[model samples]
Target: MRVLELLEEIEEIVDTAAGFPLTGKIMVDSQELLEIVREIRAELPDEIQQAQWIKNERERIIAEARTQYEAVIEDAQKQADALVENNDITVKAKLRADELMRVTENTAKQLKIGTYDYLDSILYSFQGKMEHLSSIYFGEMFTSIEKAFDDINSALAANRDELKDMAYRTQMDADDIPAPSAESEEEDQ
Candidate 1:
């Protein structure tokens, strides 16, 4: 499941917990909470792996660009060789070949520059997306985790206060109860 969906589910779980009377306390099942946490842990690695895959894809694109550049250079060289076959029109052939070579070299240089620019833009886009994804997801996760911990802490503090209140009430009620006097105890004996 998506991280956002998991976060929503956890929020729902917390929202659905039974609230304690007159306190910021909610009762949550430990097993259910643990299972969701386990799923989140499982999802994190897959997200990281996806980032790795994008890096690999960038490298693959660069390699393909290099291959195309080499092929263009090679094809241009072959055409130049084909144009230089005869001694009859050697001067004309040499001029045409040189022109073709210059054009081919310029085109090759342009193609290389264009390829690098395109790849750089794509990689920059991917990097931006990765940065945004990490910031958003990690920020969400940290916010959720921090909220959950805060809620738990509030619940614990409330529980402690309730226990103290109960203990005090019990002690007061015991104090109010009548006890037999020493003379009554002696007469009874």
Candidate 2:
């Protein structure tokens, strides 16, 4: 049933019970009410388990992306280093260092572009997966919230005896007087 309908039903029960003593068994059985609460507690672990699995998956994907990105960076650095170590083997070791430097620069630029392109594609794939999983997780979360609220309402509606017990406790608390302040005590003395 909708929330409004459920609330209206509870209100009707409360109105009907106004003609009787609040401590009577006319509303809910105390043992059964306790059982409902225990059932709710038991189901809580399942909800937590679902949340933990989603969290673990998200962390694992992020870690994998970081490892891949770092590996690509290291490989690019190694290639650039190798290019710089050339000693003009074709020129009998007589060529100017500037010639070798130009070749190394061009090779490094190409390797950088290639490495970054691969990383970008990997990042895009990771982002897509994250988005899809997040949507599914959030959808389940809302359903859980709705179910929780419904369960609470259902228990409250069926257990009028529990509500009366609470009401009496509230009345007792209100009837008891608080301790006098220091100023009031001094005035009495």
Candidate 3:
């Protein structure tokens, strides 16, 4: 009876020893899982920080580009204002030139009219005197000469009877006509 009991106890001890290797394997697997979790925890914060840095750089670049664009727009507006000012100045100069030309033309026209008026006054003042002088020099002399010519033509055109009548009328005339001569009367006696 004691030998049987000792054999049974030795068999139980051998079974427990075989199960120790499985427990050791399980502990090793648990330690490997813990190490993997530690590595993930170590690397995650660095990746997140890098992502945040990239986002901040992109925002900064966008702000800088916007500032440059606004500056360019402001410069263009200034140039346009300068152009408008120059145009206004040019237009004013042109209008002034036109006004000056008009004034000059009007002055010239007035001067011409004044000169013509002066000339007309001189001519009108002298016209009547010139015509009167011409008429006095040649008027009554031309009429007397024409009458003498007409008398000579009538005497030449008379017949003998008309001449005898004219001589008898001359012998009888006193104050209304003039006698030829007293010597001619004695010769007739």
| lDDT on C-alpha atoms for all candidate structures | 0.74, 0.53, 0.49
Tens digits of per-residue lDDT for model 1 on 88-162? 566676677678667766866786677678767866886897688768765765665676677888878978999
Model 2 over residues 70-182: C-alpha lDDT tens digits? 66556555545555556554343324334444555565556556656665675566567557644754354345445445655666786887889899999999889687899
lDDT of residue 74 for candidate 3: 55
lDDT per residue for candidate 3 within 1-189, as digits (tens), equals 232233333333323432223223111132433444355456456645655665565555556555654555455445445555577855665565455555545654554455456545644544554355336523433343344345445545665668899888877775566556899889999
136 Cα displacement, candidate 3 (Å): 2.5
Best by TM-score: 1
Candidate 2 has what TM-score?
Answer: 0.35
Where is model 2 more than 4 Å wrong at Cα? 1-26, 87-189
TM-score for each predicted model, relative to the true structure: 0.59, 0.35, 0.32
lDDT of 1: 0.74
Q: What RMSD does each model have against the real structure?
A: 5.0, 16.0, 74.2
The total of clashing pairs for model 1 equals 0
Give the better candidate number (2 or 3) by TM-score.
Answer: 2
